[model samples]
Target: MNQSVFQKAMNEIHSRRLHASAENERRFQEINTVIPELAEINFQMAQTASRILHGEKIDKIRQQNLQAQRYARQLLVTHGYPEDYLDMHYTCPYCQDTGYFQGRYCTCLEKEIASLSVETLNRNTQLQLRSFDQFSLEYYRGLTKSNTKGETVDCYAKMKKTLDYCIQYARNFTAHAPSLLLYGEVGVGKTHLSLSIVTEVLRQGYEVIYDSVGNLTSQIEQEHFNREKSDINTLKLLLDAELLVMDDLGTEFQTSFTDSVIYNLINTRLNRNLPTIISTNLTPGKLEEQYDERIMSRLCAVYQVWELMGEDIRMLKMKERRSSQYL
Candidate 1:
């Protein structure tokens, strides 16, 4: 949980409380102007505490308060308004929009924190535009690829299976879900499918972080050297997020610091059994060449590796657009 995120959630909860209070006040003023008898009943109800302080009998005051409330309701209904219209309507009734209950944070507040944390992490991502439904198999039609087992297979069939698997993975995602490594040439829909999974997992209310490897590494490095003047612990959030999607894995500016940070990130998340999705243009050989053996070993042994097979979808789309313009 990031401190700034927590503070933002608290601020939102405070605003909600203020809004509810303001609305309640507004309704009271309206009803007071419309029905003066209800206003008198309200004043009498408000005097319960003062009467108790003045050594009045507690039971008598409690009875009087109940009678006043009933009379107020009757008056409201007789005046053609809902009996409970003047009641404070909190967004979350359990906490009265206060964000806490019984000395602990409420579930509604926790949900807000999780939602805001995801939003903060994905602030720069176009997460809303991608989905499994938007992924097309037409690009891979009439294509074929030889699998590692050396069998000729239809690329369209292969991609269809890959898409279905990704959909199921997203639908069934949990914190303990297995990590994934999606590898293929550039523009083969790796980022598309990864973002699709991210969209579904987020809809399921999990905190997900998605970004390019280069961008994430750069931020981590900047924060490490105290060059980025922000309180957010980017590395910690990446490690602690429910799901992390790292795109374009081999494109980062390599440095001793970045290499160490990347290794630590991969290693720590694996050790904690947290799920991660990594998309890269690098193959197994190139990945091993770029990262050290430890990182390679974890990815090879633990991650569910998927090779996306197709010609560049973006290039195909561009050619199709060009052909369409001529017609």
Candidate 2:
């Protein structure tokens, strides 16, 4: 989250690209070489500037950049011309290689790539469990069980506001942001909002993780029952991430061990001041009934619970689309 990590990443990127990694460096240097055209251009600029140094040209040394531009165009042509290219090309597109865009983080995008770098989400080597951009709000309908006039205006407003709030929170997250619990029915956008936060926080340079409750509990169970120590490493990852998000909490296969683990996780995080986000279809009262009041009450002290209400937005959208087709 601080600046040193970014500096290290930059150094690593350069080291991986230059000098000892000559073949890799060659790829970029090929674009930046002081070729014959570039050398001629530089020689002309220096010759004219020497006159200026002696007070001869007087506000009339043809701009060095202008000379470079002609050479750049010729270089593009020799390589096979493309009309309307960059007036000037960027060598390192990030930071313009100046290292910062404006006053904020120059390697701004480094944050975005970090969250996905985690083993479960690593886009480089495998398919993601889900993707943030693929989330659709069309799954939520504004209706609760009481009545359905398609969807309630109140529910839509609240969910939309919630989405906006979650986005803002992710953009502005700091070390002390409170933990969150997104409680709702199936397809209510809880997972979407949670994934969105993970995506944004990673972009902002914090390590975050998202996992299903069932997968988490199963891993914990295996780690506990097995004699070998290495498999328990999965739980270690969960406990170690900067922000850990557990999705579909109540739906996980519940055993006495799982119940104890869940309580321990919530309580341990609260004690350590580590942050966690949990999503479940269970209500607060239902959670108490399912896991016992003591564990539920302790969670209430440290987490903000958001109750999501509405029909599945996905189902509503699908029906709406089919109705439109019939019409």
Q: What's the count of clashing pairs in each model shown?
A: 0, 9
Q: For residues 1-327, could you state the per-residue lDDT of candidate 1 as single tens digits?
A: 447888998899999999999999999999999999999889888888888899999999888888888888999999999999999889999998888999999988877776776677678665554899899988997656554445677888888999999999999999999999998898989989999998899889788899988988998887778754654667877888889999998899988788888888888999999999999998888898898888899889999999898899999999999999999
Query: Cα miss at 2, model 2 (Å)?
Result: 30
The TM-score leader among the candidates is: 1
Residue 285 in model 2: lDDT: 68
CA-RMSD of model 1? 5.0
Q: What TM-score would each prediction reach against the true structure? A: 0.71, 0.58
Write down the lDDT of every candidate, Cα atoms only.
Answer: 0.87, 0.66
Query: Model 2, 279: alpha-carbon shift in Å?
Result: 0.3
* Per-residue error (Å), model 1, residue 77: 18
Q: Which tens-of-lDDT digit does each residue in 226-258 have in candidate 2?
A: 875431245655665688888898898999898
Backbone clashes in model 1, listed as residue pairs: none
